[model samples]
Structures are given as structure tokens and as C-alpha cells.
Target chain A: MNLGVDLTFLEFLASLPALVEWNDFTVGLVAFAVKFAILVGGLLQLPPLLVWIERRVPALMQRRRGPNRVGFFKWRLYGLMQSLADTIKLIFKEEVVPDGAHKVFYHLAPVFCVFPAFLVACAIPYGPDLLVFGHKIPLSVVRLDVGFLFILAISSLAVYGVSLAGWASNNKYSLMGSLRASAQMISYEIPLGMSLIPIVLIYGTLDLGKIVEAQTSLIHWGVFAAPFSFMIFLICMFAETNRAPFDLAEAEGELVAGFHTEYNSAKFAAFFLGEYVSMFVLSCLAATVFFGGWQVPFVPYETIVALAGSPNIAALAGIMMLLLKASFFMWVYIWVRWTLPRFRYDQLMSLGWKFMLPIGLANVVGTAVVLAVLRFK
Target chain B: MNPYIPVIIVLIFGVLLGSILSGLAAFLGPKKYLKEKMDPYECGVPKVTSGSEKMSVKFYLTAILFILFDIETVFLYLWARTFDQLGWLGVVEVAMFVLVLVVGYIYVLKRGALEWD
Candidate 1:
């Protein structure tokens, strides 16, 4: 209610050095380092595991054995180690630079592909704030007030990598694939962003952390409050990520491996890793936005604290809860990828512009009208 | 520790990781570049035409449309963030704004800007 005195998380962080003692600075630094390590490590480690899941889940669905031959000794662990073996092989394999390729952009494309994925991850809040030595430290790396917009802006940069890869490759298929990728991402981004607006309208804030806190219970979750928006967001998310049903960018039937067709070795692996990491980040965003992030449904923070009798345990539980929700969405990614067939290029474009865009606009208008009527009462 | 400081650290870390991985492969990987291997892959057959030709105008149309609609979304975000304080007036204003965009969208569709052959 005190609009004049309200300070954003960035402002609060800026004021820390002035208020804290010398010893407290050391503590803060140490805590920051530890949090950074955990966040970065978990993000980097997840894609390989996802690669394993992507393989094994589809295999089970199709009644085929997938990658059951890469593990130490006799216990193969259902070929979970296949990702590791693939990484090793990629690291040592020979890279091919196609003749007549634009050498600079070709090499730079993979770096551009991978960087934005990790950059977006930096804004995602994985757990509730932790109380350390009477200091409340947020579990996210950054807490920008405009965090949601920041995410959209950073992610938009990812198209450059694909587009550049296509242009720089000097290969026809790669060019087509990249063009499809840019077009798909650009088209879907409208509905993806439009669907998110109603939630922002309802919550009246763009900070993802505050959005999660607002949805403290299942009933308060954005999914229930704006179900249509949730559906639109989920559909658009698939298209944005270029996953199944919307993965025309890499349609194997025509494009032959898509944008990365000419890429090889670790350069190729960068694009591969970037795709999975982007998937992970998008799933996490879904969890944070629609689901009650870090909050157990039907269970409040007080109940969590009461049950655990310690803030640390409760925070850990919150992290696990968020991860569980995010991982489920990730599984849905794989499930949908295998279950549905890829959309034709025209069908994909029409769906974005005709269906999703109109529905998303209508949802925003509907939410606004409903809110206004409720307020006038 | 500024909140954004961690974000900077993460960005630097990402760049480093990408460069290191790519650099390691380039240094360690075998290099026996054959002329045939360096050529663009076309199902292992000989090339028909050069790859770097001017693309379709449809891609350019999509890019222009993306910029137009994306700007509208930015306004929507700003309006949503301040909706509660701005009250019903804000709702009516944004409604009209969206309505105008919807008309443009309809025009685009009718004009077949989104069509692909």
C-alpha cells in the first residue's frame, strides 16, 4: 500500500553493501557463490538426463529397446550412461567445415545458440527464499521486477543462432531449416506472450517470484484463474520450443536434420544441448507461471515449516516440489513428441496466426471485462 | 552482492563454457579434410545448384509481421502491469487497442500474408 516507499529486489540488493558489516559481506559473498554454483550446475546437468529420458521414453512407447548398451559392468541402468558416451564421442570426433562456408558466422552460431539458454535460466527461481544467519536470501540468481519481459527479450535472441547457422552453413537444407525455425519462433511468440498477459493482469506484477508467492495455494494458481490462457500458453510453448506437432523446423522427412545439418563435433553438440536446455527452461517457466512454483498444492508454507520444524528442510522441500513439477512438464514434452505427428509447414503457420493469436486476444479481453465487472460490484 | 551480479556471472560462465567446449573439439579432433567431405551434404549425391540463393518473400513478410505484433504485446505487458491502479479506464483503452490490432490481423489473414505455397 505504501507506493512511495516500495523498493524493488534490485534496489534492496543494491542497498546491501551499505547496510551490512564487513563480516556480513563475506557471508553474503560466500552464499552468493554457493547459490550460483548450485543453479548453474543443476541447469547444465539436466539436459543430458533429458536426452536419456527423450530416448528411453519414446523407445518404451514404440516397444523398442533404446540405448541399452552403455554403462559400467553388467548393470546398464537402462542405458542412462548413453548420454555420457555420446558426449565423449562428440568431444573427440572430427569437425567438418563445409567448403565455401562463411567461417566466422558458422563458428559463432553454436555459441550464440547455447548462451541464451543459460542466460534465461539465470532469472528462473528454483526455490523459496532461505533464511541464513537471519538474512533472507532469495533462491534465484536475479530478481528483476520486469523478470518476465526480460525472459521474453533474452529468448528472442536465440533465433539469431538458428538463422545464422542456416545462412552461414552454405547448405540448402540448413537454410530452409533455419528460415522455418525463425518463422515458427517469431509467429508463436505472439500467442506465447499474449497468453502470459492475462496472468500479469490478474497478478498485476511481472516479477516471477512475486507471481509464485501470490499463488500460495492450488486455488490461487494461474492455471485455475485463467484456464484458457494456460492452454494457449502450453500450446504456444510447444511451438516456441519447436517440439513435436510444431517441429517443422527440423522435419526429418524433408529438411534432413534441420538447421544443424552441416554442424559437427562439439559445435553440433552445442546446438543439440541448447535445444534441450531451452526445453528445460521453458518447462520451468511453465511451472513457475501456471503451477504453484515451489509451493506444494494444498499445503501452505506454515504447514511445511511446522512439519519440518526447520526452514532449511522446508526450503529443500520447496526446491524438490518445483523440480518435480518442472520434470513432469519435461516428460510431457517427450510424451507429446512421440505421441503426435509433426504439423505441415502451412498448418503450423495457420495454427499460430489464425487459432492461437485470436484466442489469446479474446482471452485477454475476457479477463479484463471480468475483472472490471468484479471491481464495480 | 547486487542481484544482477549473479546474472553477469552466469552470462560469463555460459560464454566460457561454450567457447571452451568448441575450442577443445577443434584442437583435439582429427583433421583430415577431404574435398568430397567438405562439400554440402545432399543424401551423399553430387550437388545440383548453389545453396546461397535469395529466399522466398514469405519469410520477410513473417519477420515484418512479427515486429508489428511484438510491439503490440509490449504495450499489453505494460498495461497489464499497471491495470489495477489504472482501473476500468485502462481496460477500455486496452480493449480498443487490441480491437484495432485484431482488425489488422484480419486484414493480414484476408490478404494471405500468412499463406505458404
Candidate 2:
């Protein structure tokens, strides 16, 4: 079939696959591929583990045995394999594409959920630079200039997943649930955005790495610098991520599994994975921005290097520190999930819009006023 | 050394991963289609109506409010980035700017635009 025009363009397109060289750019691309794989692979492992935690923690709270029977042939790895077993079962379960559902978007929705979680993972500073084979590689994937905003931009796209899931399912419960979920996410986003302003104002940079460096001391941390900002951020983080106390989107009592009611098999699993990854993503952000990204409190960065005996080891320490801090927030996520009851739709909206938004705005203004006065004086 | 190369790669990776997982499930999972099974869940009752209807206006209102506040934040981000250089003059100007917006915010509140019921 002879198509119209541009034979040479097609030739270039065909030859594009053959383009390869061991240049710096290609080397960098290879490095990025490895890093991306490691980061995403690691995150892929997290959901099932988090699923385990989510189950076990709630069971512990409720004083029940929560999957303690999923042992390996009398070994009983203490119910650790339960999520894995559930995952395998889910993968093999009957795939159900409900009648009248939008085929394209029904499948596409979970992609929207998982993509942002992985993309924003690139921006988070895992640690200081590591002397990887003496090349001084930074322990992050992408080094975009608009770091934090890039995170907000991408992570906010997660709403598209839940909203799309609800719409495409062609179910009453799903549609209403999606409507509520999308609105709830958007409502909390105002305070989420407002809270970030104080961090940017205090640090005067969009780069997470720079912010981490600036918070060298405990008192200098963002939580102390803008306590209200941190509070607002923490509140919105729970609401926006759709965790309990704010998980009106998937309120099982009212919505019947809410957005994912129609999903089954791997598509359902994808939503589960996406939710856990997003929780981890937001927890990492809270730790990085407010609690000091990778800083070891009371000990200087140079002191850490000296104590650890190498820059590489020190970088590992930083990574550990970041994970430690982020995991604390993750614990809070689970704790809050089990502790607080779901917010009423009206209560959730009013909290995000009326209560949190105004306070977040005031916090930003207060932070600016104080910073201006202190610097000028 | 395009930063976007990695981002683009990750995006493509995401698409491929999602499609692959869904396809695997489609291939691996058991298939038995019945009319009742295919129908949307309605608590074990026969289907009475289609799934969609008119939604609350408050959702759109919240969205409009979000757009306004989100734009304000973009400007706030720019100001925050150059906050130190802007000094007292910047503070006063931004304060006045926010004050003007606060009247609108108050109007939004008093008019009960944020009310859920």
C-alpha cells in the first residue's frame, strides 16, 4: 500500500531503532534505566508488603489473628506470605469485564493511578551523592529544576484513575463514588498546595535536595520553621490520599467498595498497588519536606560522613534516615486508618475547604510576614 | 542528557507494565460469562435502572474553587521562590494582594458557597 508523502521521514523512523553509541548520553540513559528499574522494582515490591502491614496492623488493633495461618508448610513466616498468597489468587481469579463498561478507559484507569506514583518517585532525593565508581552520582533518578511542583503536578493526576474507574464501570455506586472521590481529592488539594508555599518560602527553592541540605539542624527543620504548614500538610495528605478518616471515596458502608467495585482480577490488584504506592509517595514527601528529607538530627552532614567512614556509607545512612522518617509517617497512615472513623461527605468537604484551607492560607501569610521581619531586622 | 528522556521512559514503562499485567490477567484468569454475572452489582437485586444520573452541583463548585485557589498557589510559588530578594516591599504588596482576595474569600464564606448541604 503506497501511502502519501515523506518516504525519507519513514526511513529515519525505521532507522531510529538502530541508533546506538557508548557516548555520555547513552551511558546516562543506561544509568537511568538501571536506577528507574531499581526504584520502580523496589516500589513494586512495596504494595504487597504494605498490604501485609495494613492487614496485620488492623488485626493487631482489633485483637484478632489476621492471616497468621498463611504459613509455608508448617514454617509459618508469621503471616508474611498472606499478601503474596492473596496476590497470586487475585492474578489467577476470573477476570471480569462487566457488560456496558468502557473497555478502553476501564483498563486505562489503573495506568493513571500507578504512573504518577512511579514518576514522582524520580524526584524524591533518596540521599546525598554517592561515589558510585568514583563518578559522584546523585542518589536520585531525575533532577528536574521544578522538583516539588513536578511532584504535585504528577501525583495530582492520581485522581484521574479513581474518577475514571468510577465513570467507566457504568455502575451507580461507582459513578457517585468517583464524583465524591474526585471532589474530595480536589478539596484537600487547596490546603496541600497552600502548605507547600511555606516550605518553598522558608527554603526559597523548589529542589528537594536543597531543602534537605537547608534543614541541617533539628530546630531548622521545616516542622519547626512552619509548624502550622506541617500540620496542614499532614491533614491534607491523609485526605488527599483517601486514607481513612477521609476515605469517603471507598467508604464500604455507603459505596460498596466505591470506585473499584466493578474491577476484578489484576485490574483490582493494580488499584490496590496504586493506592499503597501513593500512600508511600505522600509519606515520603511529608518526611522529606517537613521532617528533614535525609538529615540526621543533631549530627552534621560532614560529621555523618566522618562517622560512617566514607561518603558512600554516609549516603547509605541518609537513605536509611529518609526511609526511617518516611516509615514513621507510613505507620501514622496505618494508625490513623484504624483509629479514626471515616469522615462524613459534608464533614470532609467542610474540613478541607472551610477549616484547612483558611488555616493553610494564614500559615503561609504568617510565615512570609515573620520571615520578612526577621530578615529585615 | 535530556531529563525528560528518563521521564518519558518511565511513562512508556508504566503503559507497558499496565497493559502487560492486564493482558496477563486476561490470559491467565478463568472465564465464564453469564448475564447475571456480567450485570453491574446492585445488592443481588434485578437491574432496575442504568448506572448514571445527574450529580450534585457542589462538585462543580468545588472544582471551580479549586481552579481559582490552584492558580493563586502557582503565583504564590513564584513569590515564595524569590521571597528573600522581595523583602519588606514584597511582603506588603503580597499582603495587599491577599487582602483583596480575602474579601472574595469572605464573600464565598458568607454566601455559603462552601456549605455542603
Candidate 3:
């Protein structure tokens, strides 16, 4: 018996540019595919790594060994492989659909939870535009004119997942958890939006890439220009992600597993992945907006080009720098998560409305006043 | 090459990934349906009432407040983006808009709409 495999598809993929009309648009499509792969692939890979980091950091903080058993024979690397093991276990575990549950919605909630996380990543520029085959291509998957607003609007839809999951479970705790989660998200979202108003005021653009490009020098970063708004935005980021000390939705002491009480196996894993993805996206946004995204502090573009000997190398270095900053913020998330206790529901609500709202409002007015003064001068 | 193409692609990817994972679990995992196991959890005791019962009105109040403030913030974003072009007039307009919201906010606080207890 002779078996022959067809290699035509592989050949066709290699010959795509030649087979199709080689124009700017077609070349752009190819470039976009590569950029999309890099962005999505990079983001998808992060959740597992974040899971590992989250576990290890808390263990180190608490003086207990985290997951020291999963790696290859005797070289555990402090349980770095635990996330992998957990993924496998979750995938193989039993998935239960509670009797009398809303069948369609029960399945739909996890999808809703996970989708927005990926969608938000599309707008974030991972690095400066790269020159590919003499053509300039943006590092972001999508560079919308209103990149910031797109991110905010899409990320807000994430609340639907928790609310729907809680309601569909037909469980009291889940319902309460969803209610708290939705309420907290909506409440904090005001400050989140308001805090960014000052950044837009200073940057004068809603496009995140343009905002980053404006911060060519270290002093031009939004953090230094508007420290108050940065502080408020950082606080809101924590609350928006359902992280400590604002993670009342999943406060195990009171609400069991909260909105995810009924989820099992992969569905449960989906929510877990979504949370980590959201954390990463928020960190990236913070780095891009408040900090100089992909900008090596004090290093000019010409300096980077001279040091790297090529623009592509410089762009890669910029990408690494951006990732470094974003990762630091992600580490902060874990650090805060392990250190702080969850807030009481009453305290949480009051903090969002009474304290944060007023401060955010005042910050906006202050920013406006300062900007107006500068313009007149 | 539309700017939104990547967003649509990412969205489709997310939906597919989510569906595949959930479907895989449903297909691969063991099926054991027990009446006790399927019931909505309430510690170890029987649930007092259905989970779908009416919740507190405070949630509604919070939602209303959110819509009001969130819309104001959106307006702020628009004004902020174009603040330079609009100059002092824009700042004054936004200030007036915010003053109106502050009044509403104070009224919300006085009514105890935000108080959980």
C-alpha cells in the first residue's frame, strides 16, 4: 500500500502573494493576519502564565510552597507546570448542568465572559508600527480612531456574563453575587471613565496609539502630567476587574463561589481565564495610557534606531518594554490580591459613590482648569 | 483591511474558543444526574424560596445612578477630546454640565438612595 499526502495547500499558502494581486490592500491583509496572530496568540498565552504567577506569589508571600510537584522528574521549577496540570484537570473534569437551570443561558454566560477579553486586546498597540517588506504596518490588530472608547464600551459588556450566569443558575447566592458584581462594575465604571477624561484632555486624542506616541519623553507621560487622574484610574481598574480589595462578588466567605457557583469543569475554567485576561488587558491599558506604552523612558526613537541598528529591532525592543511595564502592573494585581482583604459591600458602594465619584469629578474640573489656563497662555 | 476587521476576527475567535471548551467538557465529562445534586445550593439545608424572587430596590437605584453618571462621563470624554479646539467655552460648558450632575448626585445622597441599610 502506498500513501501520498497532498502538499498543494501548503504550496498555495506560500504562493498567496503571487497568486493574489500584490497591492497595498492585499499586502495589508497579509500584514494584518500576522499582527492579529501575534496579538491574540500573545494574549491567549498569558492567562496560564498569570495563573502560575498568581499562585506562586501568594505562596511566597504566605511562606508556603505553591505547586512544587508538577514539573519533570526532580526539576520542578517551583510548580511552574501547575497551571498546565490544572488546565488538563479542568478540561477532563465533569461538567454539570443543574436541573431547572436556564439551559441556553447557562451555556451562554461563559462565552460572554470570555469574548470581550479578546475583543479588548485587539485595539491595544503592542508596539510601534513595524516596517515589513518596505511597508509600514501598525503593531495593533485594529487601530480605530476611537480606540479608548472602543475598549471601554466592549469591556463593559463583560458584566453581562456574571449577571447572566447568576440569574441562569437559579441559585440565590449566585443571583446576589451577580447583583453585587454588576452594581460594583457599574458604580466604579463612572470613575473609570471620568478619570480618563483628564488623560484625553491632556493628550487631546482618543486613539491610544496616538496617546502613547505623544509621550516621547519621560516627562510627557500621563502619570506625571495628571497624577491625580492616574491614581483614580488605577483604583478603578482594580474594582473594574473584580480584584481585591474590591472582589466582593467572589468573596468565598459569604457567597460560595459567587456568580460562578454552578459552573463546572471547562465552563468554570472559562470564567477563570476571562478574569485573568481582563486583568492583563487592564494592565496593558494602564501601561499604555498612564505610563509610556512601549516607550523606553528617556530614550528617543533615533536613539533606539541607532542602538538596535534597525527599525525592526527597535520596534521589537519597544514591544518588550511595553510588555515589561504591563507585566509589572499585572504583578501589582497579584501583590494587592494577596495582601488586601475584601471590602464589605456597604463600604465598597460608599467608596465608589461617595469618595471616588467626587474625587473623580473634582479631578476633571481641575484638569480642565489647568488645560484652559495653559491654552490661554 | 477595515479597522474593525481585527476586532470582528478576535470576537469570532473568542466565541469559537469558548464554545469549543464548553462543548468539549460537556461531551467528554461523565454524566451523573442525581436530584439532590441538581438542586440549587443553600448550605446543607433546603432552600427557603426560589432564587428568582424579587431582589431589593437598592439594586435598581444603583443602576439608575450608574446610567446617569456614566452618560455624563461619556459626555466628558467627548468634550475632553475636543477641549483644545473649543477653548474656554468648552470648559465652561462642561463645568455647567457637571454642576447639574453634582446637584443630582447630592439629591441622590440625601434621599438615602445609596445607603444599603
DockQ of each: 0.69, 0.67, 0.79
In candidate 1, the second chain superimposes onto the true chain B with a TM-score of 0.91
User: What's candidate 3's DockQ score?
Assistant: 0.79
Which lDDT value does model 3 have at A204? 93
Off by over 4 Å in 3: A1-16
Question: A1-377, model 3: which lDDT tens digit per residue?
Answer: 22485557777588766778767788788887887787667766787888888888888899988878898788988788888888888988888788868999999999989889888988898888888777888888888999999999999999999899999999999999999999999999999998898999998999999999999998999899999988988899999989999999989999998999988899998998889889989999999998999999889877999988888888998899988999999989999998888889999999999999999999999989988998865
For candidate 2, lDDT tens digit of each residue in A242-354?
A: 88888888888889989999998998898887888888889999999998888888888999888878898888889999999999999999999899887789988888878
lDDT of 1 by residue, A292-345 (tens): 889998999889999988887888998999889998999889999999988888
Pairs in clash, predicted candidate 1:
none
Give the CA lDDT, 0 to 100, for residue A151 in model 3. Answer: 94
**Between candidates 1 and 3, the DockQ winner:** 3
Tell me candidate 2's interface RMSD: 1.3
TM-scores of all candidate predictions against the true structure: 0.94, 0.93, 0.96
* Between candidates 2 and 3, the DockQ winner: 3
Q: Tell me the docking grade of candidate 3.
A: medium
Name the top lDDT candidate.
Answer: 3
Query: A106 in model 2: Cα distance from truth in Å?
Result: 1.2
Error of 2 at A31 (Å): 2.6
Report the C-alpha displacement of residue A359, candidate 3, in angstroms: 0.8
Error of 2 at A105 (Å): 1.4
Candidate 1 lDDT over B1-117, as tens digits, reads: 566776787788888887776666888899997999999988998988888878999999999999999999999999999888889889889988988988898899899998887
- The DockQ-derived docking category for candidate 2 is medium
